[model samples]
Target: MQIVVKDLAFGRINMSIEKDIQQQTFRNSYQKATVNIIFSANWLTEQIKIFLDEEHITPQQYNILRILRGSMKPLSTLQIRERMLDKMSDTSRIVDRLVLKELVEKKLSTADK
Candidate 1:
């Protein structure tokens, strides 16, 4: 036996993402998968935004901070940019903001010379 959902109760949105988007059907399996990936990415982004909002940081800054933390040692801006989620992000600007917030410190490395 199989069942199909035609419509879902609006009140159940918290439990049903399909209802939230008012979309439950796809033209093909690939379409469904693509939608799922996009939806998941969006959900993850929103959750991250909410988590960082309390700390007054943008995703780029948070990414840099996380990268620095995991590095266990200070990294150059190029290194930070290489590990960032947005490869095109301006790592130097993000680090500057973080420094102003006292969430990060930037120091010059003479060895790089």
Candidate 2:
């Protein structure tokens, strides 16, 4: 693994995978496989989060925008909330922020009536 040191205080963090794991510690292959997969997923998520930090948006917010863009239709706050991967307690607040950014708009459809 290739490590990157961001701060001299916190020590080094892994930034890339340069080597493959050749040894297994567990007797149960299935359990070991599952653990390895989950560990890899979390590691990947952390790497992505580091990249996303530059954008000043959380992963949840990114997901919401992706969902809204995919819909191509004006989605109500409730609809957007329902489609979000992260069920935020304040969907209105999130939508409001997106609206402020001009990334999304809020409009009442006839169905709302």
Highest lDDT: which candidate?
1
- Each candidate: what lDDT? 0.75, 0.67
- Which stretches of model 2 miss by more than 4 angstroms? 1-24
- Give candidate 1 misplaced runs (Cα > 4 Å): 1-17
At residue 47, what lDDT does model 1 achieve? 70
- The estimated TM-scores of all candidates read 0.76, 0.68
State how far residue 41 of model 2 sits from its true place (Å). Answer: 1.4
**How many clashes does the backbone of model 1 have?**
0
Superposed on all Cα atoms, the candidates' RMSDs to the truth, in angstroms, are 11.1, 8.5
Q: Model 2 residue 58 lDDT?
A: 67
Cα lDDT of model 2 by residue, 1-113, tens digit = 11232432323654333233454366686867776777788876887687657656667767677777678577777887898877754788877776786666677799878
* Cα error, candidate 2, residue 48 (Å): 2.1
